[model samples]
Target: MKLGEPTLDQLHIFIAVAEHGSFGGAAKAMGRAVSAVSYGIAQLEAQLALSLFDREGSRRPVLTPEGEGLLAEARAVVDGVDALLAKARSLHAGQEPSLTLVIDVMVPGEVAARVLGNFRRMFPTCALTLRIEGLGAVAACLIEGGADLAIGGPVIGDHPALERQAVGELDLVPVAAPSHPLARPDVAPGESRRHLQLVLTDRSPLTEGREFSVLSPLTWRLGDLGAKHSLLKEGLGWGNMPLGMVAGDLASGALVELDLPEKPGAHYGLSALWRRDTRLGPAASWLVDAFRDGLGD
Candidate 1:
């Protein structure tokens, strides 16, 4: 607050220098020219008609009495601005910082890597965290204030709090190594279905209480996609795998697609659940779009 004029930018710079104790440090942190930072601080002090800092350069800038009051206010203002910018940048760059997105069990590490890699590339300064867990875990995170966004399986998610979106459809088709006996054309698809199979999800296809329950049999039960893919590649067993997860192995002839009599599948589902009563934070809104764009392909 000032008699002549006031600027949010000037106050921001002043607070940065005051907190950092150096004009150069503030400039470096804010990605602004050193001279510009110093000038902005000078303008801020002039408008307030008070010497905010005792900048005699003895050691560090000591705050004067009037500056102390302003410092408290400035901190709150700057923190608000930071949150605002994080939201704005998420919208602009199509990525969010400090986001908690729910991930499905079948969502491979590779897919997460690609999306988060692109996000970090676009917003280097952002703080992005990834939580990898089951679909139930994902839904719990979204509903209980643990995470801002989530990618949960429809099978595990039944919460009335969520607003789900159909980003893209994925097939959990069975795959095996090229050299596996059933992979040969002479072997019938029905015969292949009986061979040893690798199960990925913790819960079987029957857990959803679907009308149908005749799923193909797999001998080995594994948790992660990487392990399942590895087992499949080794000709240990056929696995109903995420198409995206086995892309590399398929292309490289390390794994061959198995023809299943009945295609046992799961829909690539995403449920964005927030407290409907509470307004969606700017960060949350931006994150929803970012994930949609990434997975919508």
Candidate 2:
């Protein structure tokens, strides 16, 4: 059966009222005047040759069985309409690619800053915006076209069209201030076993199952390296450091490295992604490349 339909705004208003059980509730949700919302629903009913809301003999309107059926169809129609609108908005938001890049909080501290800094320097015309979110959220923003590009951890799942490239590896080293007793250049063998670790725990520290010092006088837990560093520099506790972030600090003696028995590093990679099916406009395409060139990705 060929079905003709009411417009999306009308359909949306219908669904809002259908779900909310009151025109006034729907109006509040839609942020539309009650009269406008009512008119939209009325138009939707007229276009469909169906009475969507039950008229209680000029009393408060209610849904009949037929109205119940219409509500089901209305929900599906509204959802599709919402998706179509979102796709259009994503294109508009991502088309030019002249917007901000949000970096995940877990991203390499140096890489995030460098990527944005170089992106702006290379394309001064394109405004560079920065934000912080979780790794999963960063990927979602890129896919949703809300964010142009992000430099963060490896995105799980298959994204054939999305460009996932590695920019650098993160060498996680136990680090501390020169004033700390653990600031040693060489561990003859098991010397590091006695060192106390200031750990970051969104979960147990990655070093938990490994052969290393556990701060048995267990103290000083931080969720962010920035916070840990602030405390570390204040002589609060010793913790692991991203080599990239502390390179300058280490060189200038602002921080010192504690020797590890072996290489303990997380292979941190930066990935650039976009929809395979969609063509980024000149501006967005250029921004993608600017990100690559920044990291030499």
- Name the top lDDT candidate: 1
Cα lDDT computed for each candidate against the true fold: 0.68, 0.64
TM-scores vs. true structure, each candidate: 0.58, 0.48
Report the C-alpha lDDT of model 1 over 69-135, residue by residue, as the tens digit. 7898888887887878776866686544456666776665665667767766655555666676553
Residue 126 shift from truth in candidate 1, angstroms: 7.6
TM-score of the candidate numbered 2? 0.48
Scored against the true structure, residue 135 in model 1 reaches a CA lDDT of: 37
Each candidate: how many clashes? 3, 0
**Model 2, residue 111: C-alpha shift (Å):** 6.7
Off by over 4 Å in 2: 1-100, 105-129, 134-137, 140-148, 155-163, 185-196, 199-221, 274-280
Q: lDDT by residue for model 2 over 1-297, one digit each (tens)?
A: 444578878878887887788888999998989899989878877777778788677556688777788777777887776656755664665544356566656556555567566655655445556767543556666666777665555533355545665544455666778887667666556554455556654322322343332433455655565787777776666776667677888899978876656443455555655556555565556655665565554
